[model samples]
Target: MGVDIGGTKILAAVVTPQGEILAREKRATVAEEGPEAVISRLIGAIEAALSLAGTEPARLAAIGIAVAGMALPGEGVVAFSPNLRGWRDVPLRDIVARQLGVSTFLINDASAAALGEHCYGAGRGVNNLVYVTVGTGIGGGVIIDGKLYCGACGVAGEVGHMTIDVDGPRCNCGNFGCLEALASGTAVAREAKRHVAEGAETCLPQLVGGELEMITAETVFQAAQKGDPLALEIIAQAASYLGIGLANLVNLFNPELIIVGGGLAHMGNMLLSPALRVIRERAFEVPAQAVRLVTAQLGGSSGVLGAVAFALQQEAEVRP
Candidate 1:
């Protein structure tokens, strides 16, 4: 069993060792009800999957959880999650393990996604690879020697927080010039709103009825598809920044492949083309040419499947 506890939703799954979802369920996190209520929702989701799969409690070996936060291994506490509001140091692993009566563990969602990709997606057969998710925010995870890599403090591949410009827009991470500040979904919305405020003519204003508050990444993507120059410019700028950050990763890790996932990646070659062009231009030719970058195969389900695979790997380690 595995769960991906997202800010607004929970995805629960019974998965096999190969990252296949035998059964799965998704439900709202309802986090506004606080930690206890959120826990109940998580359990409900798991029970739903179990019911769907006809699996008994004793049949389950272990449970894995993937969450987004600044978490330390063996701590089971959510240090901080901007997406999950009013949360700090919540004892998540203890709560789940106590309620479910199973061996349980939690991992960062990005790392879990990386594991999923490495085991079942573009990273298959590669000992070294990276997973880059460009969604509401930019996140990354690293795999080395056929295993997930967690940094010394466990928040290893927080590539989104890397500073690219010292005086750029302020980021929610309380930092200026972070790559995410310039390239995340929030950045796209901000850029679109600014352009609208400047009286730029586009279908976005009409689509949102002239309310800049209605500006969003989805709307910007739509506008770009409609050939709105301003929206296209914003996306291009974001792609450029993404390329710069990827160039850094390529130089540092020399991974065999880099898998791009999340909503922004759905733009397909539109979003990937510029970033790929920039990464190739900036990174050293030897390693750059060797590294293959592609979009992720599994969609939203990757995190939960990866978490399950992680638990299975742990179980195998303890046996024999």
Candidate 2:
């Protein structure tokens, strides 16, 4: 069993040892309802998936939870989560374990996605790689020498928080000029709305039927697809920032590949092509030449699949 708890949705799945999902369930996060309500929804999703698969909780080997926050898997606690306003020091693993009467483990959502990609997706057979998800916010995970490097304290892979522009917009983490603040889906929407507010000569406002608040990153992408100059400019700027961040990662990790995933990945060449150009221009010749950047193969299920991988790995580590 595996569960991915994100800001807007909870995904739970019953996956086979070979990384194939047998059944899955999804629920809206409705985080504004608070942590307790969110946890209740998460549990409900898991039970729904189990029922769909016709399997009992006790019949599962183990359960892994991918949380969108600073999760300390060693302590089974969610240290902090920007997505859920009131989640702090929440012992989620223990609560789920007790509720379901099964072993449960906690992992950072992006970190679990990295593990999933490494074991079953684009990073398969690659010893070193990075998995970056560009959605409501940017999140990342690093795999070094075939092992997930969670750092000394298990909160290591925060590639999005890396400050690229010293004077850029404020990030959700309360920092300035983070990659996420500049290049994520939220960033894209914010940039689009700002342009529309300034009366930019674009069809963005019309795309959202003059409701500026209804403008989203997808709306911007749609306008860009129609050759809207302002929309194209916004996407270009965001992709450039993303490329700079990826270049920094290339120079730092020198990994063989970087798997770009999440909602923005759907933009395909429009997002990656420009970012690749930036990476090649900014990174050192050897590292940039040696790296291959690609989109994630697993789509929306990556986090849950990663949780499944983590559960299997953890179970193996404790076997007699």
Runs in model 1 deviating more than 4 A are none
lDDT of 1 by residue, 20-50 (tens): 7898899998777877788888899999999
Give the per-residue lDDT of model 2 (tens digit) for 1-320: 98999988899999998999999999999999988999999999999999999999989999999999999989999998988879989999999999999999899999999999998899999999989999999999999999899898899889999999999999999999999999999999999999888888999989988999999999999999999999999999999999999999999999999999989999998999999999999999999999998999999888999998988888789884
Clashes of each: 0, 0
Q: Residue 292 of model 2: what lDDT?
A: 95
Q: Look at candidate 2 and tell me the lDDT of residue 306.
A: 93
- Candidate 2 to truth, TM: 0.97
For residue 113, model 2's alpha carbon misses the true position, in angstroms, by: 1.1
Question: Can you give the TM-score per candidate against the true fold?
Answer: 0.96, 0.97
lDDT agreement of model 1 with the native: 0.85
